[model samples]
Target: MKLLCLSNGHGEDVIAVQIIKALYQQTDQIEVVALPIVGEGIAYQKSRIPIIAPVKKMPSGGFVYMEARELWRDLQGGLVGLTLAQLKAVQRWGKQGGMILAVGDIVPLLFAWLSQTNYVFVGTAKSEYYLQDEVGWLPQTSFLQRKLGSVYLPWERCLMKNRRCLGVFPRDSLTTHQLQQFGVRAHDFGNPMMDGLFPEVPIVEEREEARSLRILLLPGSRSPEAERNWELILEAVESIIAREKKRRLCFLSAIAPSLDLNPFCERLQAQGWQQNTTNSLSTPVQDKQGLEFQKGVTRLLLTQTAYHSCLLSADLAVAMAGTATEQFVGLGKPVITFPGEGPQYTPAFAEAQTRLLGASVILVKKPSQAATVLHELFSDPDRLQLIADNGKRRMGEAGASSQIAEYLVNQI
Candidate 1:
């Protein structure tokens, strides 16, 4: 048997990787192919899975609907051509009489349905939490619309209930229940986004001088904007250290593999942070690889290895990222975010994330206010625990990928 996997965004690609890996463990006889819609399938390629569909990096960074300028830029970037080629590939693969796992929103679901193959839909994008009880208010949808569904539109729901779809997997239990209410066969074993994250605990020595607060900085994965976010986060960190002189603050910047660290290093140097190679050695907790920087009473460690370790070690995170933030919150770590002007990580995205993850991720409107927010959060342990518990409940536990793989294999 052959299985084809289709994913839309970077986060979807990562989830696809986990599910694909689980599928591999289920059977060696089956062949798997991945098709990434947004960015290049780097994660798939790294896993030695063959990527059959044509891929492109859009000017919008896969967020075309967020802004009209991005849509226009992507159109000029051969979006139509790339999409047609991908559809043709899916059609040809489906003709081989194998199963397709569509892992994204409506687009992949529709594509797989159109392919005339038995498909499993993994709805990673849409969740009822975005519309119903996220921000203590209802979205401006009609009563009929709410009765049908909030996140999944009527047309999407119709397709999801199609006979060709063998199973439907939703990211959360609420979405699963909503689909079930609509008479669709949906299940939630846990969020696949929370899978495969193992964090190593670090050994600590008693220090009588001052207590340390560890903060992980996630500046995101997109270029130029990611660099810009790093600068902004550094500015906030400087403010944090300046204001709280009593406690020793340690910052760990989790650099995405796709990002260049040169610009980030230059920004830190400009902010008067000096590299301290001999003073602090890289430990296993630091992924045994990282560059250490020191400024006043604060220390910064920059690492491009083991993102899970960074998330595990962080008491709190200052993030301008997307999937990484959700994963951090899934681990019950609270995060602080600042909205930026961009093709991604905009105010709308921040607000959506705030609603999606609940109070686990706090959105600070201004960058300058981030320091104050972090300080306030740190001072209130009860509030921190509340947000952390909310995050745990929102993201759910891991092991969804294995459950999905088992179901798919057994069904086939």
Candidate 2:
């Protein structure tokens, strides 16, 4: 059987890669091709997956909804033409009896449904938590939501309920149950995001590592936007150090390989951070993740090759991201998030994230306020424990990819 994987955004690409990897583990008879609606599908290519269509990196970077001007800019960047070409590609694949595995929001899901072939959806965007938790609607539920019943929205639910949709795997079971209420073929198969977070060698925290407070920094994976977010992050770091000068703080900057390190390093240097080469900052496991830098009692490590190590090494996170923040919370760690000037991490997005993640995320107005939130966060251990429990429940468990793969191999 032939299969086409359609996804949007870097996060969706990564999730699709996880499922594809699991698919290979389940069976070898199927041929797979990927169509990353956003970016160049770097994650797919890294895993040796074939690209079956032309993909473009738009000016909005797939966050056109953040600002109205971003959508206009994408149109000027040939967004319409690129979309038409992609639609043709999908139609051709459908004519060949190729099934689709859509991982993301409406864009990919709509495309998959339009393909006229059997398709499955891994709903990574909207969740029932956005409108209501396991109980009822949130306090801030909009007028539209009170009537809609589900965060899947009316038209989105319609697509999922279609007979052509072979399966629907939501990020969490609560969402699956809600979609099932609408007669959709939704499954409570955990989430693929939690998988592949374990490195070959886990970073062990002992001795000095246990003494210092560790923070994982996730600015994001997008290009220019990530570079821009770094400024606010550095300021937040300074704010954090200024308030708690006595504590030994370890900051792990989990840089994506796609981003240029020179820009980040230059910013650190300008901010009076001295590059450190000595092994004195022992990580207890593998020789610290990446290059280390120092300023006063605080140590910052920028790592590109050790993504999982960076996530595992931190006790908390200062996040301005989507999937990365969710992944951090999935580790049962609380995140202090601040809005950024973005095509991605805007105030609107951050607010929605708070609703989606529940108590796992602490949203602040500005970067400078991060330190204040951290202070309060550390003050209450009981609240911290509750946040941890809420996070693991929100992000769901790992191995969803394996389960989905097994189902597809046997059923689809």
Per-residue lDDT over 338-398 for candidate 1, one digit per residue giving the tens place of the 0 to 100 score: 8887668888899888878878988987777878888888889999889878887788779
Model 1 misplaced stretches (Cα beyond 4 Å):
134-148, 200-211, 279-284
Worst 10 residues of 2 by lDDT: 280-289
Model 2 pairs whose backbones collide: none
Against the true structure, candidate 1 reaches a TM-score of 0.94
* Candidate 2: segments with Cα more than 4 A from true spot: 200-202, 208-210, 278-289
TM-score of each: 0.94, 0.96
RMSD of each: 2.3, 1.8
lDDT of every model, 2 decimals: 0.84, 0.88
Instruction: Output the number of the lDDT-best candidate.
Output: 2
**Root-mean-square deviation of candidate 2:** 1.8
